[model samples]
Target: MVGVSKRVEAPSQGNREFTMTYANFAHIRDIAYDLTGITLSDHKQNMIYGRLARRLRALGLSSFDDYCNLLSEDSPELHEFINAITTNLTAFFRENHHFDFLKTTAFPNIIRKNMASKRLRIWSAGCSTGEEPYSIAMTLSATAGFSQWNAKILATDLDSNVVDKGRRGIYQEDRCTGIPNEYTRYLKRNPSTGEIKIREDVQEKIAFKQLNLLHQWPMKGPFDIIFCRNVVIYFDQETQKKLFARYHKMLAEGGYLFIGHSENLNRVSNDFTSLGKTMYQKK
Candidate 1:
């Protein structure tokens, strides 16, 4: 009699195929804009999902929804989420031509005009780790009697983790591959870690900070040269335009802005005049 009643299976909500929901994408997009002033387009949904999925697993959360709820709970977690998602790939003398332009043209001109002051201010915006600023320091150090002059470099990045690493001035030998042999000679190898670390002399000349470019900058600068290369590609057109305008305001008259090989400021911001091939001068 008990078997006479037919058993009915309740409708299974079986294995919900994971997809990046609009709500989830919007949450990530807002965080990016709030932290870095970079707007994530709808096309970057997959990127957001890929970058943040690990956070979910780490926290033992089974869903993106739960992970986001955790992020909202504390400022530290929010920072971790932002740092995880921001791209910070950079290398020393990444585009050789820009440095060549600096060595052959810009440096000579600046030194001549400011001989009395013998002062130079360079800012490496979006400087991931320490390569670019260290390269600039090496270049200045190589110039005869540069130590006698008032020369300094300021390097900043959005990720606090990378900024801390940059401040430490340590690097693996493999990452220093493209670094010139002369510069390598200046680096000291730690016996314990077998890691190459920038000498204190070179490191002392540069300062590193965690800066979110989209936010109000703390330092007022009439910087002689600003290297913000390869950073704007992640931003939308509007964000790029606004950022360039801000950069123009920060530059000293006749100062230069070096952008990525793929970037152009021609139509975006009229505050700068094209100086040819990824170089622009503030008007």
Candidate 2:
């Protein structure tokens, strides 16, 4: 889209606006893909302009060219750029069926299969604000015999802001509304501020970290379950293929992979067999 110009209206002080030339948008698209494997479609031009314009204003720059140059130079503002471009949408047990499957079927099988080891490892990839891992902890806590098991949940995301929030384990009361009544005991509600925090026991089960899926991973995992829901939908098919292949390698044999409702293994990967409802089992 180089040389193609899209006018973006900025705040009017003396009738000035920013123009996002095609080159600027292209540079952003490439950088996003190279840094995080997120593919920004052409239709996302408006969104790109909107999100990046704030950075320009914050840095006191007048043009997208200046912003792009700063990014090229690998300034500290790169972190802010990634944060601004990334989208995180998650909730406690957002897809209720996945949790149900975990509690009713997967956990039972895992418990029996690992009777001798009594160890469990779960990774909540793209766990926004910690809800998913906390929910997992609650479900495990409710399970029989789980107390005797050595278990941990690793929650990670590309956004540092959300990872920090997850580490804090705090949320406004409404953000936790999806939590079932039975799981309510795992939360401590603040009466004065109407905020909720996961009980320390549950919080301790999870470790939150900032991670880019395209980058080299720090942990060597034979994870029993991986919750990468809603994350790969942002990437191109080739990227998704490579990512799923990496996931297949990381997972223990017969481990489960839960993805977004709209995503599938079709054409992208053959390493996992569909268990239905956006869930797959490693082959």
Candidate 3:
């Protein structure tokens, strides 16, 4: 029902190993929308085929219809299906401006505003691997007085694989190259192994969990800041509306919302006032 961009005839079966009929693609898109609020456009058919084909091969399923049937039965492969479809491209300090904004504005404002409570809560929704939340943790650790404050970050993703990876806090050495020199103190590098790990103290500041944005959230939050960057771009306008409304309810007074560079709240929801560079403050 959701993300039905268009209907087109299935492509010619030239040299392809498996068949992905239009009906099969349609069913998969519907399932994806229901499960993750992602709008899979027609252009993504090849990508979807490429990703899910591995599952088909692994399960020894011969065709998309068979795979669809397995999914229809709510097979355990559903998790793998979601994981395959979701994108996890990320980097340390991927959007440097957001961190800069935090260091210069949000953190100071929150520090002044919540001096009595000395509490800070941040959520990194759709945190791919550990980079985004680790970046947040590094930023917080670099802040002068936050060490004594009750600061915690919640990092969550729909993909269980990435969630587990994030929880481990280990990454390839090159994956951390973009981390600022000043914030590098929070990381440790294994010289021989070429692996980088977030220090235990910094790692302790975050809690990683596998979560679906479309599902019920377990934690009751009036979070001070939420970094849901590059996430809502997948959802349709209606889905975005509901999501932002929920975010408005979850945020503390004057809480900040940081979105992706390519994402905009315009024509989606007016619950937050845009602060430029994809940053927003709850109205």
Candidate 4:
């Protein structure tokens, strides 16, 4: 049960602040957990308040209770709510070392072993805005004879907004700064607006879709690599355990898993062994 209070209190601003009591905040947190498997701690109160405040105005609702009621009553609105609250902070070659390993070791080994099949399968789970999958595409495109192989990357996120952006394969020119010089071949420049784009060839290798990791996955996989980096950090221990188990099942034996630098599987999982940094190998 959420903590329901009689008195509604809003933080004071110049005019009016969003009214969110501890009870309402608790309910929101619970819904987020139930829907997306993300555990929002108490400290995220201000963040939740700030973001959902806009939703309240858009819906013409005055109270957090009304918003929570709408959430229970409506399904489509829940999707919008999830899209709004989810954090999507990603960039090209983020935590670059993982991609380095892929270019130097994993991809080469997998490609060599799979040369006859001429197929490469990679999944960028929780791939926000497509940078990670685009990075995967560039890594393959940079490697020797990558075109000979039928490479594919499955990029997915819970946020439909970010997934659509990734599918568009366009980014502000400044956002492409972190791309390495060797892999710059995969980017094209639009002189009209100076926007940077993932080359169509590279873009073709990826499929962007909206997915919630807690839910059932539609695609069957024996993927060579999976990047769930900076994603499960928000999940509870049990949720992380289940997800890692699913990742283990989805991966080929000795396949790679790349997680956030701060994340670990020490206590939560035994299906994977650390290969240093945030990389893990299925055991």
The model with the greatest lDDT is 3
TM-score of each: 0.87, 0.93, 0.97, 0.94
**Residue 95 error for model 4, in Å?**
0.9
Candidate 4 Cα misplacement greater than 4 A, ranges = 1-15
* lDDT by residue for model 2 (1-283), tens: 2232354433322433688776677889888888888888777887888888888999999898988989965679889999999988888889999999999989999998888999999999999888888989899889897898889999999999999999999999889989999999999999999999899999989999999888899999889999999999899888899999999999988999999999898999999889999999998
Prediction 4 TM-score vs. true: 0.94
| Per-model root-mean-square deviation over C-alphas | 9.5, 3.3, 1.3, 2.7
Model 3 pairs whose backbones collide: none
Best model per TM-score: 3
lDDT of 3: 0.92
Ranking by TM-score: 3, 4, 2, 1
Give the per-residue lDDT digits (tens) of candidate 4, residues 121-215: 99999999999999888888888867778789999999999999999999998899999999888888999999998889889999998889989
Q: Which wins on TM-score, candidate 2 or candidate 3?
A: 3
The number of clashing residue pairs in each candidate reads: 0, 0, 0, 1
RMSD of 3: 1.3
What is the alpha-carbon RMSD of candidate 1 to the true structure? 9.5
- What would the per-residue lDDT of candidate 3 be over residues 35-70, giving only the tens digit for each residue? 899998887888898899999999999999899999
- Each model's C-alpha lDDT? 0.80, 0.88, 0.92, 0.88
